[model samples]
Target: MTRIFIQDKATFKTTARTYDDAGFLHVPGRVSKTGTQQYLRRELGLDGDPNARVTVYRPPEEVFAADSLASFDGADVTVMHPGELVNAKNYRKTSVGLIRGPGQQDGDFVKADLVVKDADAIAAIEKRGFVELSAGYTAEYEHSPGTTDDGTEYEYVQRGIRINHAALLPAGAARAGRQARLYDHQPKGSTMSKITLDSGRSVEVQDEATAALVQDHIDRLQKQVTDAQAELDKRQATIDGQAEQITKLQAATADDQITARLKAVTDARARAEKIAPGVTFDSIDPVEIQRQALAKARPSTDWAAKSEAYVQAAFDMAFDQVETTDAHADQKRKLAEDGAKVVTDKAKMPAYDSYTARFTQPQAKE
Candidate 1:
């Protein structure tokens, strides 16, 4: 069974009209006002054969009626060509006319007489096998829940339409069928389900398995994102831990440097005490002693020897201040002269029998 679905507006091919030289043709606009049995059974709320064929024509009684020759009321009934109204002068008559066809009831027809001004336009309509009609109407939709022969749960429904106006369209110009398929309320053909959006649009679902596959792909991508975020968090934690360890190591290194410096100062003070026995090095700050030792200790040199030399020089300078005897004074003068060798070409040791010998000679008593 070929099940054809329709939307709110549906279009179908109708009997073509022969072009007359008088610019008029008596063609059937609609054969049955209640529609055919096929439409009534399958889509409408009437009992009829689903395999029956339907056509558009006029009934005989309405055409032969007493009031048949009335003036064409172009006011209520509009004659349109391809969804557009014809010129007022082009329209001749619009009323019911007899159409010789099978199963046509009394007054169950619509007919129109239109004057074709353009010969080419009328010839084009003859070339095509069908004409089209558009009607405006409201419908009361009904849903009859039932199961198919294969036990598939389904619903059969129909629309009780009350048409207002039917406009004649040119051949192959009607968009109602395509528009119905796209914006239809019912899912026809092989479509099994529909997804209605919040914006009042419906989407037909043809393949359920494909939709499931797409959903699975989305879930997997979400999981991968979660895993990537977790990995990033783990890496950040490792970096934080490494930074903390580096800070602690730096603090420990600073403390070790301070301890080593303090030890060097204490050792330097002890050596200074030994070099100058009578001098009191207790008043000197330990930091200052450390600074002095650090200033003298050069790379690739003997630090012990350099420290002893520096202590001995300090001792000599302090011992020279306390000397009172001439020998001690002479020793002090020799040491001062020896220290001046770098700045002046002076004797290494001054020649002096006593402290007075080192002084300037007095003038001879003549």
Candidate 2:
């Protein structure tokens, strides 16, 4: 495994500071924390595609171990990381201070005394120019997957941590002192991850946070599309149901109309039979049958020039005249039969001929 260089920023008890006549300032502070830290793969200089990121774990045991803490004792201090391990060759040029006391575990962090011997470094600290410390160290990276107690997932764990130096950096240079070490030599853009867009384009987003936001937006839009499709399906089903109902209603209406028409034609044929017996009216329009009836009822009149209402009235009068003439003929026949019976009988009740003449009257013209 290649040795990986890592940096973690520190927080200090700035109020508990002291200065000697030689212009050296000593400050005690917590340097690093035990947790999982995320870093781009390129920052670790590991053999792989460098655009990806990895989460590394620094367990409490490894962070607060006796050997690891002791390595910080007398460690070189620089204004910023020298982009390489601090060794005897670069010690004179890079060192502005030193880790003065034995390093020890403090709560979840590692605490040590940081002494600034360089006047420029002390002046920078006094002016709040150097507000934080970043610990430079080399460690063996054990590639594995694990989760922290707080459910933070990590892909690698740091082992055999050896402190090389502590760099005093400007404020906000590092947000968390977590253990995934970032290589100081990498460019600032190394912290970003490349995200592919829908247009076959790619954009670099800052690590995980921005990427998560983009994913959430995509998920919400997909849900909206699904919901819209569901609504459309529901509406289509309703329309189809209504269409089926309309078809059934239309069929029923047609059946009703056919029944009504058949009844009207049957009624017209019955009337025609009464007016002109033995006349077939099948397959004839009712209006035409009515016209023929009117012509028969009024033979001399120009019935073609008459309105339908006038024709109907004349047909009705003719039917009434036929009913009256038939009733009178039956009465006369009965009277004649009674008179003949009287003539044959010896006991004459009133003479039948005389009785018939008194009861029956002469028929009138149409």
Candidate 3:
């Protein structure tokens, strides 16, 4: 991307457009001669091309990619150059690893270089993508109508710029690493008005089928969790029925198989009692005690008291069961969210209110 910068100076502030690619400074309004030298050195900080001949104050001729370049040969375009300042050129040279190379010295330079390479200037040139021409004078002879004046002579050569960068053209026209077709003519000014380059565009393609696949996996997992919970509920009901008959058995009245069945219920109850943080499970309610007593009551006159205790036990068991299911449901909900089954479609996913409304929400999306 070409960045536009506005610079101001004393003796009349003017807008000079500079581009990164072409190492040129486009200054409008007769650049004040008094400050022009300092302006080129300080403001534009242009050094002549390594093989260029022009100084910073060297009058810049408006040349295009097709123009010949002869006078500017060996010209090092520099904002500043070493040893050129017979007086003062104090640009801090970061001497961190100066001589770390095969043909270099220690405490040398990085941001600054001993000899600025044409490759470096070309780097900036490629960024702006300009065609270069040599700047030499060529003489053209013409007969004077009333006076004896011969045509002026000039020397020039064809200049080729190493392309730094160019904007891409849409519709598979222009691309990088491939030779770009050139336009026939050179631009008039240093900067042209809305002239576009030929280069490619990039885009991301997503298929409708991909989104559908994610939704399918979400539905399958939710169904598995739902089926598991329903089956668990059915098993608990069966255990409740068997526990009733076990309460009446005394000593060896029932077989060992019945005893095993009763133990299963106790074990399940213990598993459900695992307390969740922040939730109190120590308190036992009357309802749960009555339910347990009723399920374990013997065939005797104390059935009422036994039923009361059973109800209290039932409440505690119910609390634990409820907690477990809630945890499992939360886990499933989070899983669903990960799989795109979020809760409160309007709040989580406004796009899926209708379809996901029937399914549960995942915890993660929340």
Model 2: residues with Cα > 4 Å off, grouped in runs: 11-16, 175-366
TM-score of each: 0.21, 0.47, 0.14
Candidate lDDT values, in order: 0.40, 0.72, 0.30
**Which lDDT tens digits does candidate 2 get at residues 1-366?**
878888777533123367788868877766777777667788788668788878888888888888999999999889988998898898889999889767777666677787889988877776866757788998878889988775557899988888888888776655343221211222333455555555667787764434534643454465557868999999999999999999987885797877987887777677766677766543556666766765565557777787878777776676677678878999999999999987678345567666676669675779
| Pairs in clash, predicted candidate 1 | none
Cα lDDT of model 3 by residue, 200-317, tens digit: 3322223222222333334345555786899999999999878876776553366785677666556545533432222223324333433333334322335345554554564466
Q: Output the worst ten-in-a-row residue range by lDDT, candidate 3.
A: 103-112
| Ten contiguous residues minimizing lDDT sum, candidate 1 | 177-186
- Model 3 alpha-carbon drift over 4 Å, by segment: 1-254, 261-265, 268-272, 275-313, 316-328, 331-366
Q: Which model scores highest in TM-score?
A: 2
RMSD values, in order shown? 26.3, 26.3, 36.5
Kindly list the per-residue Cα lDDT of model 1 for residues 44-120, writing each as its tens digit: 33356865532211123432233332212221222342232233444444321122322222333333333333444
Among all candidates shown, the one with the greatest lDDT: 2
